[model samples]
Target: MGDTNSDSPTASPEAAFEAPPTATVSLREDQLQNAVSFLSHPKVRSSAVEQKRQFLQRKGLTDAEIEEAFRRVPEAPAAAYVPAPSPHSVVAVPAGTVTPAGYVPVQQQQLVPAQPQPVRWGQAMLGAAFVAAGVYALKVVVWPYVADAVTKWKASQGEMAEAKALQEKESNALAEAIQAQTSELRNTVELLQKLTVSLEASVAESKRAAQDSLSLADLRAELRTLAGTIREQRPAAAPPAPSVDVGRELASIKQLLANGVGT
Candidate 1:
């Protein structure tokens, strides 16, 4: 019995030694810090706790390690809740009941007149001074330049009008001069035509006179040949003279020839 008890105690210790060891996973310090930072991120913090846990689990984190990281994360500040009265809710009150001492009546609250804001005289005066300065600048500086430009433009327009008128006058004078020259030229041409006609007539008269002179010369030559034939055919013996005077007859013939030459 004593050996069995000792063997039983040894067998129990051997069974304990032969049993499978439990596995434990521990995150590194940097990994824990990273998990804390990820959980603390604004987007991750704004998400649902379950969704954040699932996202961390997808990144290889166990639930315990994620819980540890969440513990390290800072909590967000809680917002104060303000309650508003419901529009539909009404409180019942008796008609003649006395009101609280410090309560404002609804009619007086609604009918309270707004206080008027005091006018800033300094600002008004400053704006007025600026307006006066602008007016002064417009009247004293800008107006004169604008008026001068307008006056100059008017003067230039008048000058242009005068120039156009002068140009038109010059054109009219040139046209008149051209017309006068044309009339003079026409008169000169007519005079030249008349002179040409007179010259042609004079030339024709001269040609007729030349033909008459040639006819007179031919008549004189025929008279000379007739006188020579008469001398050659006359008788050599002296004969009794005729009653007619030959010298008188010869003088009459010379007179007729002189009359023909004059004609």
Candidate 2:
């Protein structure tokens, strides 16, 4: 049986592990010298080791290079103290010696002042000429290109503005044209609708007039049939009476009908 508990003291076969190999980088001589110079600076030397390491790392130096530079940095020398002589001290002299005229004591001798050096006018003029030449070169070689670039940029901006304005104007004109077309189309539709209504009214009136004409024609035919029947029923013993003429009455009715048709 095998122990399943996590705290079991059973030991398994030992597994040997090998450490990964460290990579080494070779540095240039100038790089090492530069790092040494940085470490030797008074301000940098006064800082803590961690601060110095961080500064060197910011300057692209690896840990190995930084350690080597710290080793190469020169140590600052210790300050020394010297005692000054007292102003009240007396000079010792021999018993029978006579003092020389205009002789000063060794301690009272004054230091000579340093003389000022004269300025060279030729070197000063040469430096001024170099400055003037540099100014002229800048004006001749660099200024024109800068001015041309500025002018081209301004021109491109103006062109873009003009193009935008033109596009806006075209859009406005197109919108107006479309609005006018729509109004015209609407007016045309209204006119057509009015004409259609008028035509329908005219067709209805024509139908009514035709119906009236047919009724009048039927009345005229019935009147003629009644007159023919009266003629056939007249007696043969009595003479024909001239007071009432059926034919004349029928003629008058026909004339009235003709007038109504004309109207």
Candidate 3:
């Protein structure tokens, strides 16, 4: 138990001499200032940036604003622009460079197209006269002639109507004349019929007279026979019957009657 205790590990002098010391190399104020000055140099420009400090001091830029500006810094973009003219007008400007021409006032030129030549009073009057003449001709000569022709045509038509009426009247008169002629012809035929009847009556009367004459002749012949018989039978009575040749006496009487009838 004593050996076990003597063999147990414990801190020794050589082990202590081998152990590390806790001594620190503390920085001095001059050394720290020298290091800060070296880093802050304009050429090196480290340690929170002397450039940012100088820029904030000289140009009134904050450190965060300067960092933002530096971060945004890229190569400048190329652009085409016309610069305003210098206040002193120098002769070194290139040919086509523009100045502040917009600021200057300019008077606009009054532009008017050329007016066509006006028609002369005489020519215009002549054109108007021609139109008026045409209108006058239409109203006076042409229209009147046309109207006269229409009137004449109407008159001719009226006359033709009159002539047609006259013709119709004449035709009616002709019809009346023809009807009268026909009536006259009918009357003439009636007269001819009456004449024929009269002629027939006259013929009947002539035949009756002939029959009467025959009967009278027969009675006379019988009387002559009786006279002859009486004369023969009786003695010559009363002066020999006047020596009567009856035949000769009858012939003389007939001759007298014939002469009277002729008269």
Candidate 4:
């Protein structure tokens, strides 16, 4: 437990330093800086301090743990950078050099190479002319064809729409005509059936009447008997009645017979 606690970064600086010699933990400067940043954030500091206070109070480490939680986290500070002398600035001396009476050491200066300027005027003008020609060609040759194709495509679409509408209208009219023809055919069939039924009934009625009627010969014989019986009932010397027109009645009867009344 002591070994584990000693390895924790949250341990006090003194406790971390007092770790066992066998525990050889080393932290780089960048790691220390990152740890300091992580520990110094406001929310992390407050929460960590509160948690450490509660935990330490429960575990009887109130003073040390609470102090460690709020204590400043040490970080690796940025070091000031010092540049080394360049070889050009260094003066070399010979091992056994003899100098003149007024000898002065000369310091060598570094020369910076000047950057060359690009001379692209002719190339730039040529590129500009090429671009202009391409634009002109596009406007003169390509755009007109594209516009004409678009117009033709739009006109074709419109024609297709109109044709579709016209076809739909014709289909509707044809459907209506077919419906009317179907209805007319049905009506004609019904009328023909009714006529057929009526004709059958008339034929049956005519047959029954023919079976019940008496023959023409039988009717004529019965009429002759009736005339004879009337003549026999008359007295031998009866006086003639003035209101009876026997001659006119007989003439009318003869005219009716001539007209084919019973045939």
For all predicted structures, in order, the TM-scores are: 0.44, 0.36, 0.35, 0.38
- Kindly give the stretch of ten consecutive residues in candidate 2 with the minimal lDDT sum: 11-20
- Which residue pairs of candidate 3 clash? none
Off by over 4 Å in 3: 1-140, 233-263
Which portions of model 2 show Cα errors greater than 4 Å? 1-124, 203-263
Model 4 / residue 237 / CA error / Å: 34
Return the candidate ranking by TM-score, descending.
Answer: 1, 4, 2, 3
- By lDDT, the candidates rank as 2, 1, 4, 3
Q: What is the lDDT of residue 172 in candidate 1?
A: 100
For candidate 1, write residues 8-113 as lDDT tens digits.
3223211211111245447544445556666655556677888877767766666777788888886676788978755554555578998788865443123457
What C-alpha lDDT values do all the predictions have? 0.69, 0.70, 0.58, 0.61
List runs of model 1 lying over 4 Å from the truth: 1-133, 230-263
In terms of lDDT, model 4 sits at 0.61
Using lDDT as the measure, the top candidate is 2
lDDT of 3 by residue, 169-215 (tens): 99999999999999999999999999999999999999978876776
lDDT of 4 by residue, 87-163 (tens): 57756779799888897878777687999989889999999999999999999999999999999999999999999
What digit string (tens of lDDT, one per residue) describes model 2 on residues 8-116?
A: 2232111111121254347544446566655555555666778867866766667787778778875565568777766655576687988899766566455678889
Q: How far does residue 215 in candidate 1 sit from its true spot (Å)?
A: 1.6
